[model samples]
Target: MASFKKYRVDGGKFSLASIDPADSPFLEGDEQAQRDRLEQLAGELDDLQNLLHAEGRRKVLLVLQGMDTSGKDGTIRWVFSRTSPLGVRVTAFKAPNDDERARDYLWRCHANVPRSGEIMVWNRSHYEDVLVPWVEGWIDKAELRRRYAQIQDFERLLAETGTVVVKCMLHISKKVQRERLQARIDEPAKRWKFQRSDLDVRKKWAAYQHAYEQALAATSSRHAPWHVIPADSKRHRNLMIAQLLVKTLRGMELAVPPADPSLDGLVVV
Candidate 1:
């Protein structure tokens, strides 16, 4: 079993350096065992989601962050396909629109947060404000530091308000990302997903890696810690994420809503 340390809450950050990818016990399991576990976890997730919806006491926010072609969309599609769409919503955060730019950076994100009885997934979340902007020099160092502190406070507030936030950072090697991007370009149907900006970002791979390291270190807190999933293999990544999500949801201790008591003796002819 992999002994993972609980993320520190005082500094409001996660120490990614502490995690060893090779130590992930799930990766060593046989294919059949892995499949069985995945199925079991998926079923439990369905039950938990239904309970959450019916109880309507708390909300869940799943935030996925990764480099280009790191399989954020694929993870969402595969892991969440079986989930009830009515109780779940997905929001993909792209570059700021005019209205978004005019407001505070977190304004647009807050608007899309999950309400009680719903689960919301963020394809790229508020972390981008600190990650991308800081990496690409769009924001200065001082502002970047400020954003980290602000994000921590924001999440603390959300947690205090009955929101469960699960932040995941899909970690893929540079070579793997390159291969995935190439595959997209080679396959006609996937060509539309490829963008020139992707290559530009790829060129600064090291910068992004350092940026991620810093972001995770600064922002992983008890309220919203980052789960760094090894994403080189799509199947393994999906299974791990599913397991983690189900485990977290089950921890909430959700129960089905009770049947209405008003109907005592209604007889059908």
Candidate 2:
């Protein structure tokens, strides 16, 4: 039960003064027990999703942000695989297209925000405008500061409009990331997963960490807090995410809407 702390950027390094995922007590549990709980949580989350969709009163937005090969894909696969696809939408944001670049940075993101009665999972999100661009030095210091404020405002607006935002940052150590990257290179089917750019980014790992630190600090708020889930163990990561999702949705007090009385006596039978 380690407490969560906001991260800050300083001299190209993430400064998390008093937080570390390795200190999480949940990881001390037995592996099999954790997996069992994960399955249970997933079931409850599926139920909650159905209730939310039927109610048609509120929306849920789950934002997953992580480094390349940090298991964003795997998290989606294992944790959300059983949820009803009809009410769930997953959007993976890659580099901006020409049209996206032409408008405001938040334009593409705002357009994809989930409507009431739906659940939208952002693979990567508008945070990228502050994250990647800032780390890569594509934007100046002043611009980065302005974008951070704008992001906070954007999320506040979403919360005000009945969209519950749950942001999770999948955290993996440099050593674990290297092992995963090497495994991808060693396996034939996974070889395509590795790219030269990954190595280039790895070289600037400190810079990326700093960028993430700044992004998390600037965006974490009462309406939307970031959950830094330790991701060195895929099973643990998946379990934590499933548990968090179930808890958040269940706490929202979702209930099925009443059926139409006019249709009650019109059955085909």
Candidate 3:
């Protein structure tokens, strides 16, 4: 199996320039073989999730951060296709409403933390608080620095409390994003998904990229490392995330509780 180490953001010198958005490092064999492998991984993930639920003591939190048209929804759809909804949950963070603005930025995210034995996936997470504010100049350097520290502390709290945080930044190319946005505009069935605001954000792509780079670097840690997935190729994005997830759950060595000795001689009527 291909290792995901190369994709990890190891603090200091890590940057997106080293990764090619179209590269398919995890791809193997031919097209059919790749598809088969993805299905296999999805099934493995389901089985692992069942073990996690049965264990009923620890949890997994997957945080997916990316720019527009970066396949956050697509990743969730395909990766969890075989997993039961009973044990998996998703939270999509949007622009702050008045209620959200009333609290500190992490308030909403802290509320949505996964319970024991559940797998909670964040489509866009608290990182947005920092990214959007910093990019739009709503906050300054001191605030940005403080938020980064607060995020790291927040994740550390989760880690110390038995939640494993898995963060991934879906690194899609600008060209690929343009193609996807155009598809939304041109395809009649997809027109409703298209928003003029998406174009407005697209105009500030470089600023967002810089924001992402800063956020990922500042928050990434041993407790919650960020992996950059080359997402120009959708197959690569799905495969890498699925593989990484299965690997993470497996590493946890989850298991159900031991049977009670009192039941040894008992049989159901």
Candidate 4:
């Protein structure tokens, strides 16, 4: 575990390109050692989740936003591998449906928030309101600014209500993304994950990167900050997010509820 001080973004001047996608600051071991550390962190997270459930006071929300092939699914698969589904839940947001489009953008997301004693991971989030629309020219500068302010306020509301939001922008290199996309096309086992529309979006890489930088700069707050994880290395990506999550949960100092004195001597037959 290392200090992630440099990676936290809080409405500051940020350049997505400034951070290398290949760098692994949080990683410090061989393949075997990395595996051991990740497993340890996963086990610790499961325990923390249990304590969170027992305490039953607050909740955690993990927001994963990334370009295609940034390993968002893989991160969730491995980071929470040791946890029970009873305590953890995941919601993956896709293109909005007609009902979702009829309401405010955050409506769908607000409905999926975590309950007390639970950790919720959002594969994509309200951020898409700003990102996709802005990238496609559907929203103007004025609209984008408004959306950002709305998002900040929305997150603040969640924080006021006892939600700890952890936002991670999984950063990956264009070269690596190309390789991953090609793998999906070439590898039969992964073909199901491939989307032809992905190539269409890939053409707007520069625009999307710019949009992300602006959105992150405008929306990242003290209550819900964003961390840019260099995801060129899949192992490091999983390790960093898992470690970040475990660390966040530990900071809550979760513990079981006080024992009831009346039942102190009770035992099952």
lDDT of 4 by residue, 43-141 (tens): 999999999999999999999999999999999999999999999999999999999999999999999999999999999999988999999999899
Give stretches of model 3 more than 4 Å off: none
lDDT measured at residue 58 in model 4 versus the true structure, 0 to 100: 94
TM-score of predicted structure 4 = 0.97
Q: Which residue pairs does candidate 4 place in steric collision?
A: none
lDDT of 1 by residue, 1-269 (tens): 23223422234444555544323444547888777776776777778889999899999999999899888998888778678898889999999999999999999999999989888999998988887888789899899989999999999989999999998888888788888899989999999998999999999988888888888878888888787887778777778788778878989988877877887687779
Best by TM-score: 3
Better candidate by TM-score, 1 or 3 = 3
Ranking by lDDT, best first?
3, 4, 1, 2
lDDT against the true structure, each candidate? 0.82, 0.81, 0.94, 0.94
Ten residues in sequence with the least summed lDDT for candidate 2: 2-11
Model 4 ranges off by over 4 Å: 266-269
Deviation from truth (RMSD, Å), model 3:
0.8
Q: Write the per-residue lDDT of candidate 2 for residues 125-220, one digit (tens) a residue.
A: 998898888878789999998998898899999999999999998888778889999999999999988897888888888788778877787777
| Candidate 2 TM-score, true structure as reference | 0.90
Candidate 1: residue 2 Cα off by (Å) = 5.7
TM-score on alpha carbons, each prediction:
0.90, 0.90, 0.98, 0.97
Segments of candidate 1 deviating more than 4 angstroms: 1-24, 258-269
RMSD after CA superposition, every candidate: 2.6, 3.3, 0.8, 1.1
Candidate 4 positional error at 234, Å: 0.2
